[model samples]
Target: MRLVIAKCSVDYVGRLKAHLPLAVRLLVLKADGSVLVHSDGGSYKPLNWMSPPANMRTLSPDDVDLETGVVEQWIVQSAKTDDRLIINIYEHISDSSHDLGVDPGLIKDGVEADLQRLLAAQIDLLGDGYTLIRREYFTAIGPVDILARDAKGATVAIELKRRGDIDGVEQLTRYLELLNRDPLLAPVRGIFAAQQIKPQARVLATDRGIECKTLDYDAMRGVDDSETRLF
Candidate 1:
């Protein structure tokens, strides 16, 4: 990944239009061909971004841009569409790249791991016709708990928690954002499931268009089943 801290302005042209006035921001160019513009605020979400497998080209500032103090500009064009993220650089504070070798993927504790296994085995619990794509689906960021397809064949990212909270929702949101970048999964939806969910978390999940589901551990463990009963 290449990380650049610079003072620059940004613009997006395609599907919709957006503009970010001159400011210092963290621009991340991931190995996966994802370009993200992030500010000090907004926590983990990027201010602007171009998803993979897009290509980037650097162009010298034109007459008007040079007059505006732009040193150079980067044109990041999406391969799937005409959407573009343009960055006009005025000053550079720092720039560096790193080789973050193979990732080991995220690890979960015993309960979380078991829950993941159970869910993957009985994915139908998610919904009728829900099919499991894979578990621990890795992306540029981290491993998604579960990746599946709904009955309609729409991609769905499921984040599991023993106790669901706002943080869990935010994590799922980031995963969804990255997954939707892939043309194969451009319209990824999210499901936040846990044994117990806080009220605030549920509200936030609903507001963010994520579906919240409550897990029943006892039922999944088959505690009520005669087959598991002891005389």
Candidate 2:
């Protein structure tokens, strides 16, 4: 990973367009080929970013750019789309790089942990011929709940939740974004599994091309009726 604090202006072009005026900002260049622009505010979300499957090229400023004070430029092109992010650097501050290895993923609480176990055992619930690759498929960002292969052998990342919400969908989206960086899983699909799913979450998941499944906890636990099991 590379981190640089610089005074730069940015512009994004593709399906939509946006611009960020010159200012001091943190630029993150991840090992997975993603680039993120962040400011001191906005918490953890990047002010602007380009996901993986991208390539970045640095070019010296041209004559016109020289008039505007652009010393250099970084052009990040997305391989999956026509989207591109252009950063025109005016001043350099600090730069550093680090090799952060794969993350072990977040520790699960009891219910989510139990849910993961149940879903992994009944991987077929996803579909016919689905096979479990493994649980806790670790990536640089975090671990996937359960990695599996579909009938066609494509990769699927299952995100288990006790109660599915829009937040879970966002979390799964992040995982999918990072997972797709791997050539072995370039076109990974996502499954948002939970005992209960909110309406908004379903809509967002569908929009993002993610499949949703509601788990019958009692059935998975071998209880004939849900009433027979105590919370």
Pairs in steric clash, model 2? none
lDDT of 2 by residue, 1-231 (tens): 999999999999999999999899999999999999999999999999999999999988653445367788999999999999999999899999999999899975439989999889999988999999999999887899999999998999999999999999999999999999899887999999999999999999999999999988878877657666586
What's model 1's lDDT at 76? 99
Off by over 4 Å in 2: 1-110, 225-231
- By summed lDDT, the worst window of 10 consecutive residues in model 1 runs over 59-68
- Model 2, clash count? 0
**1-231 per-residue lDDT for model 1 (tens digits):** 999999999999999999999999999999999999999999999999999999999877653445467888999999999999999999999999999998998875437777888899889989999999999999999999999999999999999999999999999999998888899897999999998999999999999999999887767776656456684
TM-score of each: 0.51, 0.50
